[model samples]
Target: MLKHALLSLLLLITIHTSNAATPKGPLEILRHSLVQEVFAFGIRPQDTNWFDIEVSTNLTDWSRLATALSTNATAFFVDDSATNAPTRFYRLRIPGTTVAQQQAIWTELRRRTYTIQVERISSSGKYLSADVTVTSGAKHISNVKDPLTGEAVADFDPADFPSIEEIFTKLEAAAQTGIYDLRVWYDPKHGYPTRMIQREISGMNSNVTELRFNLVER
Candidate 1:
């Protein structure tokens, strides 16, 4: 009987040792801070799993922020949208979750007030561009110029210039139609499109538009 008991105890110890060696999921936060109104945080994650990052202002309604793959090393993250919020909270959700719709980035941008310079190039080879400033109540556009001439547009119609909102609308439509060759790049911090190119390949409309945006002031 004593020999049998010793064998059973050895088997249990072996199982526990094996289980402890395995890495676990759900990343752990190491440190976090708000610098220059941006949320900067560090996390230690298991190499075996991916994590969904979520953030909130009230801590009750969480919004999916981003997804990250763990490398078993310390990782750093930033919340550029934090600049507009007075209070912010964040967490690392469980593995296997997916990123939410693309609209999240636009939502982040709505909270900010900034000035951006836009450069436009179109199929007609003529484009009116300007530096645009947006605030709480009104939009201020200045330095309106014709890129084709590299001169100030003496008689510029604001309606002829596409705003950021309009660019996004065009992108969304292109995405849904599945007919245009579209390539877009976004600002890492603000999540707004920094560059976009759309070429209509269907031969129905051979319009190609290229837009480049640069943040001038926050």
Candidate 2:
């Protein structure tokens, strides 16, 4: 009787240890913003191919916002609608998998980039305003263009305003012709740029421009 009891105890211990070591993908919230009011979470791609983003005001009740697929690595989600409410909660649920969701994830990850809100005044007393959005490593300028003999119209990076060094070179040139003022704001998490202001102060023709980058989804 004593030998049988010892064997059963050993078996239970082994089973419990094995279960504890089993790999199960989990989701974790990395960062969040209240003023921007965005919440972010990362989900590792596991046996399931698709996951659902469920948002809730209270933890007990959740509303499904989006169904997304995963690549080989972890995937990120940013909830911008959090800005509208006083408080919000989010979670990632592995409901099911689908081929369409897989394709959509690829497309979304490809298109996810940055947007720039540009406002500028030229030395000639002319004002140029525009929005620039970067998609798939290309920049689409909304309102402004280059008038110089040879200069880039726009640039893009996953992080900040594309070609920041090039922009500084232009700013210095503008200052040489007149006066230049530059200001920048950076996201604390990644140390990437978020907002900027550049002013050309050469006299009455001085042009002031502002550019705000969308650091993340919000």
Candidate 3:
């Protein structure tokens, strides 16, 4: 009976620690690891200088998933999006930050089965903010929020601004134009963006659009 009790206590401790924002991995060095189908983990930003996420099939011939991914948010890039290889491996490094970084930041955010706030800002000032939710793994602005009270500004509404998924779509489309710059910051725990900015830098006008996400927890 005592042996069973001790085993149960150990099992509970394991379960609790496994879901921690910073979960331990089989490896000592690689912090981010898989927990079931979901890939979730957190990394401090200081360690993310020029950081990147890379994947491999047999732990060799690594290909970068993203570069320059802001480590402030927990890292959560999906590993199955590419070819569905037999075995997949992932590693986070701080040596490169580039287009791959943007890809890595946006990938894990397909949806966490939750909702959050999206704030839009520009040089002129704040434009709009809304409480947005995920539907079928896509973001939809449910209702605008009150800036003062931080409550939903409306009941029934039209989601005017782009959703996170939509923003990624726009990002991919705009990449070909070669006329803009995108900078993003996300929560490293569940992989939610805290802020994203896109600036049209080709011409003199230099219009900047920023989205800030405030996660709403139940």
Best candidate according to lDDT: 1
Query: Which digits, one per residue and each the tens of the lDDT, describe model 1 over residues 149-203?
Result: 7899768666545556666666556444443244455655666677665656444
Q: Local distance difference test, per candidate?
A: 0.58, 0.44, 0.51
* Clash counts for the predictions, in order: 0, 0, 12
Tens-digit lDDT track for model 2 on 93-201? Answer: 5443233333344344433566555544434453334456766556665544443433444543322234333343443343344323343444433333344455443
Q: For candidate 3, lDDT tens digit of each residue in 1-218?
A: 53432232220001113235764433232244443433433433333234455666666677655433332333323333433443555565544444444557657544456666777777766466777777677656666765666766565335445556665565445444433345455465545456666656444676767677776775
Error of 3 at 195 (Å): 1.1
Runs with alpha carbons beyond 4 Å of true place in candidate 2:
1-25, 45-48, 97-218
Clashing pairs in 1: none
lDDT of 1: 0.58
TM-score of each: 0.46, 0.32, 0.44
Position 138, candidate 1: lDDT: 61
TM-score of 1: 0.46
Top candidate (TM-score): 1
RMSD of each: 17.0, 19.5, 14.9
Clash pairs (backbone) in predicted model 2: none
